[model samples]
Target: MDESYFVGWGTLMLINAVLAQGKNRSGLNWFLLSLLLGPVATFFLALSEKK
Candidate 1:
């Protein structure tokens, strides 16, 4: 049960990294931020200006 949750979180982190790269943002930074903010990070990423 707990394992699945972490797996999902890790998956989101990877996806966020990809998305961040597409937006010309730092994937490592966004991945770390997503570790803390989770879905909120994705939301902010969506609202952020793309390069």
Candidate 2:
């Protein structure tokens, strides 16, 4: 695998962490979603905050 791939994934994880914080979700949930759905999950989770 290329080094850039790891870097991009790491950056996305950080962004997901931030989004989770903003949504008031547990760190564990965010971490799990990061593993399961990557960056897209973060957006979906954020959008579902009020539901």
RMSD vs true structure, all candidates? 1.0, 2.1
Residue 39 lDDT in model 1? Answer: 95
Q: Given candidate 2, what's the lDDT at residue 28?
A: 68
Q: Residue 4 in model 2: shift from native, Å?
A: 0.6
lDDT of 2: 0.73
Please give, for residues 1-51, the per-residue lDDT of candidate 2 as tens digits: 999987887777778777777777666677677776787777777686631
Model 1 CA RMSD to the hidden true structure, in angstroms? 1.0
State TM-scores per candidate. Answer: 0.93, 0.70
- Looking at model 1, report the run of 10 residues with the lowest lDDT sum: 1-10
TM-score of 1: 0.93
CA lDDT, every prediction? 0.96, 0.73
Writing each residue's lDDT as its tens digit, candidate 1 over 1-51 gives 689999999999999999999999999999999999999999999899998
Candidate 2's displacement at residue 6, Å, is: 0.7
